[model samples]
Target: MAKGKVGKTVGSLGDYLKEQRVGARLSLRQLADQAGVSNPYLSQIERGLRKPSAEVLQQIAKALRISAEQLYIRAGILSPDDGVGGSVELAILSDTGLTERQKQSLLDVYASFLALNAADGADDATPAGAENDAEGTAPITTEIDPDSDNRVTNEG
Candidate 1:
């Protein structure tokens, strides 16, 4: 990475960091303290005079209560595709109640479910009617029995 404020990407990253800090209503000194960085260094980063490392970016993201992946994308450490995840992933990542390990586990499970669904979709390329009409295939149907405590009952 180029140093000394010449890089446009670095400037944009710095601009984004400043925007986030301001949006969080944090002073430069306060943000620096929360991010465990020096005020001068943080100011230099905001001014595009220096490009921060991924670790520093993560600290800043935590301080700003934002996604570290967003910071990584802004800093050119991760591509948009690499950081791509919908609201569920964002919620999981942003949930402060979960430990890092628990968050990672949940994310892993969610990714696996997505992959499984995608594979199933790919395998459904046959003619639409043929899918359910194939031999040994049955469409499972469920109904909530009013008589029973709303328990789901499998019909076919």
Candidate 2:
């Protein structure tokens, strides 16, 4: 992978990993041991000082008892939009670490955002003429006078 791509997400990935590790109540050494990596390396990963490989991410995910796909996405190894529609929902649903209630909550929020966007788009979809002629007024007509200097003339 290009350094630029990994650089863009390494900090975010590190932060997420640290949060997950803390939530799991595991020490850095413990996680490193479980993931079969050295303590310093794991620390570097957590501190955003180093970008981990996909294999390392998978191992860490296994150690943390979370979905490898989630780590993959965080690490920029896999795109959240890898599939088609509902990819975000799929990622949330597939995470082994989140409870059913948490997953449902996330799904609800996503649906709400989508609905809001659709509603806003609907408001913008009103016909331009409809708004101008809401009072049942005819549209203005204009014509060019052939006998004059080609000036515009309103035809009532």
Candidate 3:
């Protein structure tokens, strides 16, 4: 491919990967080691000088602890979708370390875990009262269920 085409294709993806890696507090060398890629190669990917294959992106996503589908969408390898994230699961399925039964088992367990969390969130979420406080002023309250296991504490 021409340098221009490759540059355009790699640009956003490289930026996305670099952002995720940085956000995850990983150095380029650390990310390369975890993703099983070379240090210079990862640097090239981050700088929009090289287009990474889907498999490399998957490995990088795994190392970054992100969903592979997100990387796939950023890479233009797959379009955005609203359903359950199957691409990450598909990556797990395709991995050589896991056998067929192991992959199926892992998928089943992961699905169940997601379902349980969704159910828990649905049950715990409640709107704060819209009434004024003892001082005749509306009291600021949280939208999050403090009793729940969510990481965010929403305030209004």
Winner on TM-score between 1 and 2 is 2
Misplaced by over 4 Å in model 3 are 1-6, 81-156
Clashes of each: 0, 0, 0
Per-residue accuracy of model 1 over 40-154 as CA lDDT, tens digit each:
9999999888878656777899999998988866765444763354567657666779876786688779878878877977988665557565775666667778787576856
Of the pair 2 and 3, which is ahead by TM-score?
2
CA lDDT scores, all candidates in order: 0.78, 0.80, 0.75
RMSD of 2: 15.5
What are the C-alpha RMSDs, in order, of all predicted structures?
Answer: 8.3, 15.5, 15.8
Which window of 10 residues has the lowest lDDT sum in candidate 1? 77-86
Ranking the candidates on lDDT from highest down gives 2, 1, 3
Predicted structure 1: lDDT: 0.78
Query: Clashes in candidate 1: how many?
Result: 0
Worst-scoring 10-residue span by lDDT in model 2: 77-86
Predicted structure with the largest lDDT when compared to the true one: 2
lDDT of candidate 3 over 13-96, digit per residue (tens): 899898988999999999999999999999999888887766788799899999877786676545465265566566764688
